[model samples]
Each structure stands twice: as C-alpha cells, then as structure tokens.
Target: MYSKTILAAAAIAGVQAQSSINSTSGYLNYTTVTGYFLQDLASTNVSTFDYTATNFGLINRTYPATAGLKANLTQWQQFEAQVNALNADAPLNTAYKVLFLGRHGEGYHNAAQTFYGTPDWNCYTSLLNGNATASWFDADLTPNGIEQALIAHDFWAHEIATQKIPYPQSYYTSPLTRCLKTANLTFSGLDLPQYYPFVPSVRELLREGISLHTCDHRRSRTYIHDLFPTWNIESSLTENDELWNGVTAETSDAQDARSKIVLDSIFSEDDHTWISITSHSGEIASILRVLGHQSFSLSTGAVIPVLVKVTFLPSGPPPSNPPYTTSTHCAAPPVTSIASLAQGCVCSGTAVGGITTPIFNISSDYPTSAGYQATDLGPVVTSAPAISSYSY
Candidate 1:
C-alpha cells in the first residue's frame, strides 16, 4: 500500500534508507468536495438528520455540468451526470470519487456495551470473550442489526426504483463478521447494474480500530472465506490476525494514518468513481478525518456519502504515526464505575489471570472459541477502601 504514496529508496548497510524527497515526489492530498451532499451543509444538524428521509443527503438542485440534459431527470440522475462530467473533464493527477460509507449494524458488542454501560464495558467486559449470556469476540450482529440492514436494503431499492441513484461500481467491506454480514444483507439482492455486482472485496484494513477489546479482533482469513466464499479477499491478508496484540489500542492519530494508507491504496488501484465501504464507526470516522470532512458521527446502520477530490503530489515528507498505547482494564468487574475518569473501573480485588486473547477453537457460531476461561472473574468484592487499576 505504501508503494502508491511513498517512493522506494535504497537500503544502506542492511538498514532501509529514507528517501530525501522534496515537494515534488511523495504523497497524495485528499479534499472533501462539498455542495453535492446535504451532510456537508452547515444547517443540517447531524444529530437530528435522518438520511432515509432526505434522499441520502443529496441536494435537490441543478448542476451546470449537466445543464444541457433532459429537464425531467431526477435529482440523483442529475447528480450522477454531473459526477461523470467532473471525471470526464478532470485534468492530470486529479479525480473525483463518491464513497458510500456504511457502518455495520448493532453487534453483540454494541449491545453488551449498552447492557454493561460504557465504563464497565471499556474496563472489564470487553476484555473477556463473553459473559454467562452472550459472546462478543468478533461479535455478530444482533436481531435488530439484521433489521437495520434490511431497512438499508429497502431504502436502496426505493432509490433505485424512483430516484435512479447511481449504484456503487465497486464494493468493499471489513473482514470482521458484523461488517461482512451487513454488506451482504444490504447489497445482496439489490437490482444492480450488469457491470456492478454485489461481490465485495474483503479488506483487512477496513476492520474496526485496533484495540484490546476482543470484539475488535477478527477471525482467520480461512474462516471468512468459508463464510463468504465468493467474495474476494485481499491477497496480502494473512490467515490469522497478525496486527492485534491484545495489549494496546491505536491512538486516534494512528488510526487516521491507517485510514489514509487504505484510502491511498483504493484510489491508486481502483478506477471506480462510486464505491461502497461497509465498516465500523471508528474506522469510518478516521477515513472522514483523512478526507478532510467534518466530524459527523454515524449511528449503527446509517450511511454517509462523501464526494472526494484526490490530487497526486510529486513529493513530500512522510507523516509520523504514533504507536499504539496500552489500555487500562479491571481484573474483576468493578464495584462501581466512574464515567469521568480513564481508570474508571474501581476494582478492590486483584485480577489473578485474565485471558488476553481468544482461544482459536473453531465452531459454527463462533469462528473462534465459544468462550474463554476468564480466570480474572473472581468473586466480586462488595466494598473496597482502596482500588488499583490494571492494564491488559
């Protein structure tokens, strides 16, 4: 992926030599081309905004590029035509693409987070594979999650039938189960163009932000292939997850750097202007930041479309991406949680031995183990005068 953005340099004395490229040789610049989507409008309150009601945030207006077209064309049709025009007239090293970013529906992890509350979820529950009730390691979508995806399916059908919205020319999804399931449900039966099929390429980089949470970990590539055999997996992907260390979480800056690299890979390799990416909240947020879009958080099952303008730069210094930082966790379920503090889980009892990562025993329901032995879950201490925080 770095091939597109960074120029290769010679290795000096068995160590990689850094290229001394000036302003003429490295990197790409991404700018969000506003005015095409209502999400970019200053007055559109994201919290109260519903895309299903507002025609996917498309501004129902004319475009000068499609001025000579038929007057009866729908807003979507006009928008598509204008996008085509923009691409057709684009100069060297410049291109426009519309990215449909869809977040995976409610996963068991999300429900667990809600059930346990954020503080406990962040501190204790997230570290374990599951409680007595539900499992969240590489969590699957809940029942409502399926319904949410179906709603997206129905909306897309409506848009295709009435609005003639441009269907995605290419499809991509995160390797995680929830995202894979969401992408499948949302696009499988759509009345799509002959050239554009529902076959999405599973990208390793598209998964949720790297973290110690078991849900953030992904199953093996073989397991993913067994489930979605028809979908193409990026050849570079390893069979097992090699990135997750179960000790640290990616900083926001680190996530943004990853997001930039992935976007760079897509833009350099793919020619499609309309692309669909089914991923997680954190990843989409990072991508939006890289694209220079405003911070508009998406609810699960919601989608955002952004018009992006990419410029290939000749040369620039590479960015310094910070390393992942260790996350604080509780050895046992905290007696009480503090929402205001980072070390919020107030644990009196010491966690003896907590399972850091999932046990890789294959099952139909879980690609990994059904649940791991959380030795850390000792008898809950009722009260404590002093508490100590632990890092997983």
Candidate 2:
C-alpha cells in the first residue's frame, strides 16, 4: 500500500537558501482542547450568560474591574519564557496538548429556584449568593454531573486505545470537588500511573464568589498534598497568609506563575507523555489566552485533548547574521476519527489516468454493471468502474 510514484514529463520547481537569519534558542508551542460547555449543549446563547460579569468578575463595577488593569507584565514575561524554553528542550516531534476546561453539570445551584430563577444573576450562583450555608469548594457532583465526567472519560479512553496517543504523565486540578471528580473519572480509564498536584492560587480564583475559610483552605491543601507530595502548595497559596497583607498580589499573577512552573516541570524530552488538568472555566480560559489561543470555551462534559509538538533547531549567531531556525507545529486530533490510519490520512490529488480515486470506501463491493458482488479487483471491474466518488 506504500509506493513512491513520480510522473514528471516537464515541471519547474524552485528552492531558496538564505545565509543570514537570526537563530532563536527556542520557540513557543501550545494547543487548546475545549471541553463540552453546558450552554452550548442547551442551545442557549452563551453571550447572554455574560461570562465577564458572571463567571469572571471582569465586568463587575463593584470591586474587580475587567479590562483596565494590565496583566502582570513580569509574570507574563516569565510565562512566555517558560514556554519558549520548553519548546527548545522538546524533541523534534514533541507535541503539547491542554485539556479539561468546563463547568460541572447540573449542580445544586442549577436546581435551586432562587438561583436560576433570577436573571442577570451569576450563572455560578451557588458560589456567589453570599450564602454561608452553601459548600464553598467541595460541592458534590450532581447525578448528571457524574454522567458528564463519564462522557469525558469515554472520549479520552477511546483516543488512547485506538490512536496510540499517550495518556498524560502528570495531573493537575483546582481544589474544587467538581474539578477533582472530573480528573478522577478521566484517570480511572487510562492505564498510566502518575501523581498530580493541586494549585490553590488557580483554584482560589474559581472560588471568588464563595467565602474561603481558613479551614477550607487547609483541608484543600492536605487533600492535594496527600496525592502529590511534591506540590508547591507553600508557594502557590502563601499570599493568603496574614504576613503578606500589605503586598499586592493578584490571583491572575499567581496563576501565571504557577502555570509556568508546572508546564516546565511536566514537559520533557525523554519519553512521550500526556498531562491532564481539571480546572474551572475561567482559569482554563485565562490559561488558554496566555498560551496564545485567544478563543477557547469550556463546557461541562467537554474534554479537549490538545496535541502540542515541539522541535528545536541548532542555535546560531545573533540577528545580524542569523543561523537556521527550527519550526514547530501544533494541532488537535480531529473529533470524528481516532484510528491511527484515519488520523494520518491527508488528501493529495495526483491523477493516475486523468482519474481520481476515492480515499475511503463504504463497502468492499461496489455495484458493477454485471451485478452486485464483492470483488478485490482494481477500480475497473465487470467491464466498467462501479463508483465515481465517496466521502467520509
């Protein structure tokens, strides 16, 4: 099934070599895998939900204004630097995949009449509503929510078994029950065994509407540390300490820093690895934007398994007289087909006898002029070609 054919009666081709070019030490590579959004499945206009005002608190005039504040420039720079470093260290064929940003399916907030009944109220009213009675970080997944996690698990498991795509080597999660539950469900199906860490800096932001008690924070830390001893909890959540009362530290800045550290540690050149992260929609979207993808949405059951490939070229002189630069490409596996052959199929047109052949067949036997029968003969069968075109 594999052969190289060249039909060149007359053809012209051009190749160029540039002697001077700046050789960058590294490049940036990333991909965003969007999870299933509940709003999308409901067929409701997400624009109406006002993510800026409701989920993100960006549009709120009360305390946290949305657009005026500049992103922490220093942290942003470090984040970018880490990405570039990873690109440099990654193998020529390395690809990065980011996944699991979505809402918890059908929660108590959605079931409560007082919460969902009010329009212009936050979609995440369970956290907001200023109700101390509500659980802050450890909200149990509703029955439907568990089903959503299962759906994501099924999708990921299928990808691993059929496509030979590696399961993530490391795991990360927000300190929220729903997020942790989602991670558990996904890891349950995969064969890989690895530890995961929970970053409270990222998780605290998701708990914006909920009042965080010291006890809650302590419990959350212990839960994650038990699973991942190497977790950087002290660095991640130290800002909550009374010692740093005067210093101004934004959650966004902390998140940016944490992402840099985590990404750098997880991605390596030795072996093919996958990393899974379960986090809230807001934090996931923010991380995606930081990674150079401006448009990404997370749904309840949505699972985005990003495929990131990294490559490095030889380092050369400065911009004045540059050296050869390496290139990298990032792509998500298609949602429709996970099989290895189908995954690699790309169409190129080269007519054998001024006729193009179908890339895929629905059935082995195509109806011929003589009769309907299965035949392994060439395209021309029973004195005539049985088919003209096919689509998958």
- Across 54-168, the per-residue lDDT of candidate 1 in tens digits comes to 8989988889867877678899888877776666566555667789999999999999999988867877888778888888989999999999998999999999999988888
For model 1, the stretches where C-alpha displacement exceeds 4 angstroms are 1-25, 335-345, 349-392
Q: Point to the candidate with the largest lDDT.
A: 1
lDDT of each: 0.75, 0.35
Q: Judged by lDDT against the true structure, how good is candidate 2?
A: 0.35
**Error at 313, model 1, angstroms:** 0.5
After superposing candidate 2 on the true structure, give the runs of residues whose Cα lies further than 4 Å from its correct spot.
1-114, 117-138, 193-219, 223-273, 308-392
